[model samples]
Target: MSFRKILVANRGEIATRVVRTARALGYRTVAVYSDADAQAPHARLADEAVCIGPPPAAQSYLSIPALLDAARRTGADAVHPGYGFLSERADFAAACAEAGLVFIGPPASAIEAMGDKAGAKRRMLAAGVPCAPGYLGSDDDSDERLLAEAERLGYPLLVKAVAGGGGRGMRLVHGTHELAGAIAGARREAESAFGDGRLMLERLIEHGRHIEIQVFADAHGHAVHLGERDCTAQRRRQKVIEEAPSPVVSAAMRERMGADAVAAALAVGYVGAGTVEFIVDAGLTHYFLEMNTRLQVEHPVTECITGFDLVEWQLRVAAGEPLSAWLPNGQADIRFSGHAIEARLYAEDPYDGFKPQTGRILHWQPAHATQAGRAPGAAASSVRIDDGIAEGGSVTPWYDAMVAKLIVHGRDRADAVRRLVAAIEDSPLLGVANNGRFLRDLLQHPDFAAARLTTTRLDEWAAAGAPLLQRPAPDDACWLAAAALAARGDVPTSAPAGLRPASVAWQTIALQCGSDTRRWRVRLAGDLVEFDGGPSVQLLGQEGHRWRLAIDGVTRELVALRHAGGWHLAHQGAGFVFTEPSAAPDQRRQADPGRAHAPVAGVVAQVLVKPGDAVSAGQPLVCVEAMKMEMWLNAQAGGTVRAVHIREREAVSAGALVVELDIDTVSTVI
Candidate 1:
């Protein structure tokens, strides 16, 4: 099965990722993109590109007919379904085969066998692989039977979709009273996400780490495991950080897990790339999780440590090449060098329950300059940025919120963590609310440094209202910078570009960050500033989004980027957005808690209340779904519903009013 051209039937970073390897391997690549991704990096990186349909995935990326048409138009001989949309669909493999195109993945039978969570669990169990004790259902998945099975499996079990992965179509039931709702919600999500409402129950491993082994197989009956990837750093069951050669998995443990993962692959007669997931307890006992029968999103971490390209492996296997051709020593040749860590960069507000954010990327500069444990002028950087977004690009709500992936390699785990943290902190991603500061904070957290993270650790911190969720409050120096910026008066040089010793002196402004307000009056006369409540401030100079200043008698350099009529300042890993009420009033600066408003831009999934309906404080009144994540707009204060401004299925922008109640507005945290 030799193919000269490969069509990538996906978008974003994964599509670009596949195109990179295929191009490097001397195969011309074709990219099929939706209207939303016409100018996306993936579309531009391919040898040829085709516009499939409108932005809606059903008409574009997820449409098999559209993909086949694109392939035919480009005269492509192979199709590479980059993870996510239709990547795991067995029918897609069969369709590609029928269309006389090579699907760069395992056989259709393997995907079907593992696509269903229950079926995969049963198969793993039959293959002598230990599986989590659960009801791999026998067709009777009714609410009553599932509830009964939940009782037997015990409380705090996991309700999961039988046909999907990625924490979607999954719910955690902590008690008997929650089982029914969990079942219903999980089913709805499962149906929506995977078109499969079949449910399964698994006894929750109260304390465990998420571990997966990357396995590759070829048509010559050769299979090998590429070691383990620890994905335990997760929030809401979605992996945020992934690292190779898990900090926890010992050599012996890796052997056992790797062998089991390979067996799980061979059990299905799998060919190409696949990942067998597992959950390991403190006792070192591991249970089989479902196997993903395609290349994984975190495959780069495996590649970094092993010095092998998994995508290239996929291409070779799809072309019917034997493993011996690429891996002269098979499993023995697979080796780990140094440590590597990857953190997902998402376009979301970490301070606001991690709400997904959508807007254009006014500025996009990652911290590629941060050399890892080397000289400042190191010739090469160990940092690798797997990003699909570009400056001036729009992060539409129509797709996943992840904008880029930051992966770093170092001599050790500590070195890698340090480099990654530096990369995240120095990266300036403006325009939309992002998770850069939050990622840095998480990386610097003592718990993460000590490797004390569990699957639910982030959730637990959030539930406890830990300060980890809040943005770092501005200090005196920060405030001085903000005030100086407001007073800088970015006008003609005659007025003062930025404290250029001009005749114009006195400037007073009211700056606000969140609920904290500060009234500052700066009288700049001949290099002397009347700032502070006297905290210390002196604008040394300004250079296009950068400022050198003396604050509190100490010289410091900071980034002050202006976007959307607001000032965005950054230093170290802290960022604060400030707005002047006298000029452009920020909608969020004084938000009304009694009114119903969307925290993000998304289609209204449901409206739980109507006009004149009585509601209690904290009761969910509306549901908004974006990028497959749901956010509930809850009543901040109990009162009679005065009006419902937005209805179900309506699309709304961030801070768009949805409902209002007849009550005095109360201050509430978003």
Candidate 2:
């Protein structure tokens, strides 16, 4: 390759992923980080790192000038816009070219052609590609004009951002009454997220499967599609899991879709990596969705099945290599191997509307075993974990909530699912509420196992109360293990002396969950730990965070960590936090039941309530924006606002009181 040094202009797993591959290919890599990510793993992994700007993406990662300056200072000859941030921004690509930097992506014109969803749909229709029935004309974007056209398009419409993807600035309108609101909300979100207030309307495919073809191209005008990735497993349009060699796609259908996808790439004169997304109905008919003009977050799955390092391909192509050079056999020789699945590990609470969470990672353990799953043509099964954070690293509110990408490959779909579930249970990402357990349960769901997933099915399943979300609770063994571990500390002089073992001190430990605490006296009993009035538990082995314990002769392996003044335990796919007892109970959580609280740390986007305003139950009192998500805090009960503690555009911590309501003296919080 001509380029010797490359700069990865993104964060999280995508950045690290690019860096690892580029470095392996003998290219020096530079990583750019914001102030908050000074200690991020991606930064440390790069040969050189640069501080671009502040935490917020607009002031840092999205700033083209800052990125180019970083590349210039680092003497980087190539720039890799890894997904999100400025990956699809045509201006960024153009600027890189202007600065004599090889943009390891499609040309600026290609990005512009495919970046706009409306424009891409128009071009696809002209190219004879099947497109969803919707409105993509630029006749007008006024509320009245959109409403009139939407009326013609009919109900259950999808409002999508014209400039970007990832379900941002997208909303589903099921009725005419919601069309105007959806338009406004989508426009505002689009403007905030992509700096574009434009939108397009699409007919909602409620029972459709989301499939995207991974396409690659070269300067020689040759392109090929890397089959399809079944992204049907989604929640609220956000992909939760993605797999390759879709369970539903037949060989004939794959061939047809692959041709169409390759045509879509060539239509835009695309070079480098891109994805052509499609929405397929139950009848096996597919419609063109928007195209992603840069690398995808779930590219690992396709790489695993194809045995191609896509980043390496992008690099070689950017350096003027043709398709024949990178692909020795070309498209005709392409092969799809074992099934590969990728599950996104996000720092979010699935039970609480999947709200984004922020915190320092107290403990980070990636699942790796001598036996897991193998890559294409590998000797044995192994696990793949692409993460950009480490222990003590913080998951801030300025970026995407995803902490890592856990990918696995197996001989078949069932084997992939089984290994992925065990992988999720084995990896522990503590100090932040996450969806690990929820993903495990989801993978185990019969509908998912049977390839019965659709775009709206996950949401429908949750709304119908299928109970996919179950909060973690400690069982007897876990409780005893936690107490016994906590008892290893010195006995406090303030407490009365209890029964003592020969060498190990007998101590009382209080393990608190929420407002309840389970205090127990534990003492060492040979190889077993005896609870004062409960059964004795024998700890067979204690490895790093993995403990093998036997209770009543029943053996179990649990992942536990005593960090950040608490015990983070995982048992049977459920995660629990049992904190040490505080000298005094927290008065904040005990006091205000009618207070509107921020669910996560974020900036106050808007304050809808005042000190004396009257609010009804569930009325939106404030809007908090965190990790690019706008969350509205609602009132818990009908009452008069007694006080407002936050202002618009001000930062607030998690559980910070935003507003107080004086309701009939009853306890309630939201």
Candidate 3:
């Protein structure tokens, strides 16, 4: 039966995506949001919006009761679980079916069978699927067994939570000596993160490529594979960039992997959109990783290559459609059109351990221009940007830190990389610390260009001192000149005064880039500009729309354009925006000292330190659990724990004081 309305039980970009697809399928959409997302883009885009609970995901996105109530109140006939949260929870799926709402996914039994990594591995091995050599026995005294298995599998094995996904609840053991500690840590994290302490072991394949095949099944027991994607470019096991039609995958290898994926899905009686992940070793041998029973974040790249909307197919399958025509004899030959690559634009700081960032998006502009060369009627053109937030939208810390997914398609991988680089160059976002520059750097790296990648690439890159591909543009010189001129009262005191030429003491300014500050001295002499202090700067005559600034006798042209309440200097294929009131102060301050606040709203999972206890910097003080994940709140500095305001399992708000520290001594370390 075709459902009239569907409730998207998710947040952020995926929620908006489901709603858009539902609207296209002539179905009304309902969106449930936490307090933090009440004004989010997804809520406004839905046909109806309901406030589920507080900003914390536990009381909102992960609350089964709240979700059921929202569905009932909004008269939604079906629910679409978009990738995370309750998407793979068997209990949630069963509850939805009991409530008379269609669960647009595989059966609950299927989820339960495949949700546990150990059990899933057993089933796959039994079904003749290639699996990594490890131990997945159900013995409480399995520590000795795991150590033995680690020895046989050699050094550097992975201890993964049986019920965990993402990179959480996982630890890498380099040798037998590290096995016990890694096992204990992995179990603790597994229990804290997934509410299950069970774990298993797998051999860590060195120099492996992260590959996955998309599988679609229907109600009629029909299934088909949608080729494979190369997600080798990753950071901390989290994929940073993804592309369709892996350059390293041979046609014969693709067939073998696709066949195995189908067998795994069929073994589970799976239906709807799902991904079967695999890790391919250097020898091109593949092993089953796990199956994600929902649409993937990188589905857009597959859609771009195949010209098929996986979400639409999911809806059709849920409505009792068959996949007979899509796949003949349980397999179909897939062809790739052009190369497609996707970059996840996140509000994060790569230099700061890839920490999550949140704030209002003051400005947003995506690159939408074609490159220099292109066939007259080629399928590739400009970039196709898909985002969930607008200019005024807030990037709350209560959810995933992804701001948008930028995808670009070109005739080949080289052209695709060039287009992606151009898109990042032309794109602009302000008032938030985003990883746009980081994405550009990763794309142009020699390692990535050579396709020699693995899951540990990002961690390895960071360990080698996080190197930036490009430096901040030389636009700071223009800002220094403007500031110096303004201080002397030579330029008219007005906003946006940099646009006009001024009679200042120095038309030429010399600025030295200090360790933490920019020191400037200026001298002006009519149209003939010259500087004496520091590096000699000579001003060349300004051409139309370009400012010619000479530094150390080298003439360089720059574009001075007004932007973001200030001026933007574009030079050397890079653009840097400078504001009058620099925000350097806020960036250097310690994590808000205004009381011991909850960094994120969640139930207090554990309180490690008591009131009045002396704590040191980097000590874990509290653990907050949200969305089935545990986040440790550490001490910002050494001090006496003056107060423990919140109890165990107590729900707290973002920035709400959970602990107070009395600092006896101040250290100059931030």
Candidate 4:
């Protein structure tokens, strides 16, 4: 039953991954893309490509009819929904089957059973699987009853949507004071994300480690577990970094978790690649959180450790192959060789609440010597990068912000972390803001190195105002900018005409970054540049964006890229930006004192204040949702709302005016 052609019904890196495996299996591949992804890498990699619809996911990737029509036209006999979008939708899977196309995933019934968090927990309880203590009862149909249930669960707990995955429609309630707000917000978000507002409760396991087992099954009714991955490094309940063969899991715990994961998968008569997720508490007690009924974003780490392509297994299993043919001895005593860690390179600003960024990627470079698509060797320092976008690609606000997944392999955990750090040091993504530096910082933290990571670690770091979150000093920024400009031939070629190198007057240079603006008086003479009353700088040479230079007898290499009429620099896993002061956008803000603009690019989820309404200082004027998180736009000062410029659910760019206030009437014009 091997298929002749397969239609990939997903986008980004996962799409490319599925195509790669299909090509290896000697199958023709068809790729479907939206208007925004017309020129994306995955589109070009496939043998045949078709335009699905617009940029919004609902009209394109998530539309089952569009996908079936595309498959029908392309003569594709099978459809591979790689990870997101329609990957986990039971209706989509059923539709694929109804269209006579092989769906390379679990059965529709399995997906439906596990898709609902409350139903899944009930099934797990019936099967004797250890799940977190909470209220998933069907009797609590009212919000007031749910609040009563939360009160019984005590102070700290989570309100999660029954049909939601990925933290969307999820909220944390610290106490009774926040329960109502948490429930309402969680419900709204759940309804918006999953089309269902039904929620369940769980006692928040403080400092818990997220671990999941990779399980596989086939139409032959055989299933096996391929070890586990630790995804404890998280922020806002979303995983930031993941590693396989968890450092904290012993051999005994691994076996127990694997058995439990296999049992959970078998309970629903599962098939294809699936993951069973669990939360491990401080005392090593584990509880089932949920099961993802498709391939995971962190599957590469597991592949790096096991040397088996999970996508290939997916395709093979769908072709009616038995699980024993792929998994060693039906996954009994599965062996794991090396350690691997994956870092998700997202287009978001780590410094600004990790807000999603939308812009054209002017430059993109992965930090690995070996190119992607090749299997990493057994050496401890092998690197691999799997990405969906390339240079000149755009990151829009319509989908997930992840640009790529950087994975590194090693013989052990320490070696893997070291290699990962080295790889992260060289990765440079320009044009849009990203969290690369923040991830590198977290990797090197003493607490992380000592295996102290947890679901709450990132929040703790933010609350403590960790120094790693700060940008580089202004002096360092100027030095790097000067060197980059010199390397790119942007500096002056000659000294002052009337004086020797030592007697020339300093040239004035203005630089602006983020909010701060600084002016540095500098002099450029050949490869030697001297700042006013500062040390002389020297630019040795440049290889791509990596620059080598000596400042005051010290040598260092820095990653620098020119974009948006300025230079973006990274050193020691910290990023900084420098542009001519005039290029700063503050002038626009200063031009209109009464305008309240969108702080970040996102969809306006709600408008809290209306026109002609008086608002107090710090009162929320609007709430914008971006990067899967919501942020409030507050009034700078007490004023009467003059006009509302944007509507709810409307997309707004950074600095786009959302509201205008009557500033002069609230105060004095002076």
Query: Highest lDDT: which candidate?
Result: 2
Taken over the whole model, the C-alpha lDDT of each candidate is: 0.83, 0.84, 0.74, 0.82
Residue-by-residue lDDT tens digits, candidate 3, 104-143: 9888988898998888989999999999888775766378
Candidate 4, residues 246-361: lDDT per residue as tens digits? 88999999989989999999999999999999999999888999999999999988888887778888888899989777455666546688899999988887776677888887
Deviation of model 4 at 64, angstroms: 1.6
Better of 2 and 4 by lDDT: 2
Better of 1 and 4 by TM-score: 4
lDDT of 4 at 147: 86
Tens digits of per-residue lDDT for model 2, 1-670? 3789999999887888888878877889999999999999889989999999988788999999999999999999999998988999999999999999999999999999999889899899999999999988585788888898899999788988888588899998999999887898789889888999988889987689999999999998999998999999998788999999899999999999999999999999999999999999999999999899998888888888887778888888999999898577888768888899999998888877788988878767776743111223333444688888898888888888888888888889998999999888888787888888889989999999999888988788767766886465677777887776666443222233353333466767778875568888777754567787787777666676777778767888877777667888876556688888777856554545576789789888778889888888788888888876788888777889999998887878988988988885553444
Residue pairs with backbone overlap in model 2: 373-382, 593-668
Residue pairs clashing in model 1 are 117-162, 532-535, 596-659
- Candidate 4, residue 87: Cα displacement in angstroms equals 1.3
Model 4: runs farther than 4 Å from truth?
A: 137-140, 369-381, 474-506, 510-525, 530-538, 550-557, 582-594, 612-616, 637-640, 663-670
TM-score, one value per model: 0.90, 0.92, 0.81, 0.91
- TM-score sort, best first: 2, 4, 1, 3
